[model samples]
Target: MIRALNLEDLGSWLLKANGMTSDIAEVAARREPVRRFCVRPGYRARLMAAGQPVLLWVSGDRRRVTPGIWAAGELTGPALVADGKLRVPLELRWLDDDRRVHRDTVRSDGRLADLEVLRQPQAANPSFVTAEQMAALRAYLPDGCGWTPALSPRG
Candidate 1:
């Protein structure tokens, strides 16, 4: 059964891209207007929704591409089931090679060391990123990338 994601639970997410299956360099070079990322079917995929922030993590050593967060964007729409798979529409806000955050860097940070992607390397596509982790990652992003956490009601 399909369930609605809780708005209060919304936060940053990590979407892994396999370098062997996907040409990271080509995708980064194209700077496509919009892209659809597929996530493994399960609870995690069901939690995804439109307007939530997303980070594209390039996985695998293929093409000599360093594995890490290569891009940041927002989900343009809710998860859609196509061909028996779940896909989320994304619109990238930042995708600069210089701004790429390497896995080593993230591991070195205490706040990001326990990231789901790092903990379970072979985990499914959509990985959860806590608000605190997202804040820590913001430090690595360059100024004017237009990345800002969604304000809370209490704030």
Candidate 2:
């Protein structure tokens, strides 16, 4: 299950000394360049030691009137302070070009509205998404949308 996380909401979600830890164990279990990022140093070290791959979902800023998965990235190097805050190095693959997916589409589509993660107060932090939810999100993608999978090589 992919975890739906708030990228800008730090009040509810906490990050490690370096980066955020994975809420899902499967993410840590993967190998060969985990398709994820912003992991706690310990977890990141563990994955590095195990030679695993991590996948992370970055939520768009709701305050900025943006919502939905914005991008996914693979951790590359140790976390460092950039623009004043410690940040993990990542090669990000953007999921969407525009922030069109909103509460309307989410509620209008039976597949999207059925997602349990989104059912709660959107002001909360990162939440888990079942495989069915992930599939539904993918299936709902409009034709010719610029969105791409997290694994794809970013242009």
Candidate 3:
């Protein structure tokens, strides 16, 4: 069973999906619960660990999909070096259509305006999300949206 996430302790990250090899929208529509995400070698890859919360940001302008936070979940295991990159195991649940946080919404929010994903749109995967930004993002997620707050953001 999935446990409530302690955002404060687990922290949060933004995983970017450009929908090049695999269309993020298609992946989100899948019934699969778990996905193996690979990130290029870097410091951020080294910082990832099990249980940390992550938001899947679907980048790029797809034909019918809006680029934004499409899914949320926690890392299932620490990053593993494989094939010269890091593989992060996670179980993602796609947010409801009405619950998916849009990119424009985040860009408009003053608290989230400076999000790394916004500043470095072309940056590699695994962007950092500040505590303040996470708190702001949480406001868009309603109860039963798959994320259960287990601790205060400042905790």
Candidate 4:
């Protein structure tokens, strides 16, 4: 399993550090360069698309981060997700693109629903990764309207 380098919170949802660590593992597992970048006030993907060190706005239950907010450091949490639903609490570690290390834990509310894996495209054309990598990337997702697994590069 992936280990935590660090973690943060926006509301109550705590994005897993090991998740990102697993990302690093995937990079190593793939044995190639991983295009890594922190988000601005948006999702990491958009931040990279627009520019580096962009502002990121995360929405969680525990941490209610106002829009256009900025922070710099690691964050961690013990959020509980019932049946692994996204409706659980989150604690977003407030940090910037300069920092690369962070972590969080996803706890289910003892509801063992079958874990669903999905896939999509990065842009609109064609390209995808596995549900594993997709889930890993989803953990870093910022708050937005079009931000869904259907809108991302999936396997």
Best TM-score goes to which candidate? 1
Candidate 1 error regions (>4 Å)? 1-10, 144-155
Report the alpha-carbon TM-score of model 1 versus the true structure: 0.82
Candidate 2 lDDT tens digits, 11-85: 111112111232222322232333333333332222231111222333333453334443343346545556564
RMSD of each: 4.5, 12.4, 6.5, 17.7
lDDT of 1 by residue, 1-155 (tens): 22233335435778888876777657687876547888888766766766678888888773478778888878777779877878988877546777888888999999988777888878777776776678888889766444455523211
What local lDDT does model 4 show for residue 83? 47
Give Cα-based local distance difference scores for all models.
0.73, 0.36, 0.71, 0.24
Sort order, lDDT high to low:
1, 3, 2, 4
Which candidate, 1 or 4, would have the higher lDDT against the true structure? 1
Cα error, candidate 2, residue 4 (Å): 14
Off by over 4 Å in 3: 1-10, 144-155
Worst 10 residues of 1 by lDDT: 1-10
Q: How high is the lDDT of residue 148 in model 4?
A: 26
Off by over 4 Å in 4: 1-95, 98-127, 151-155
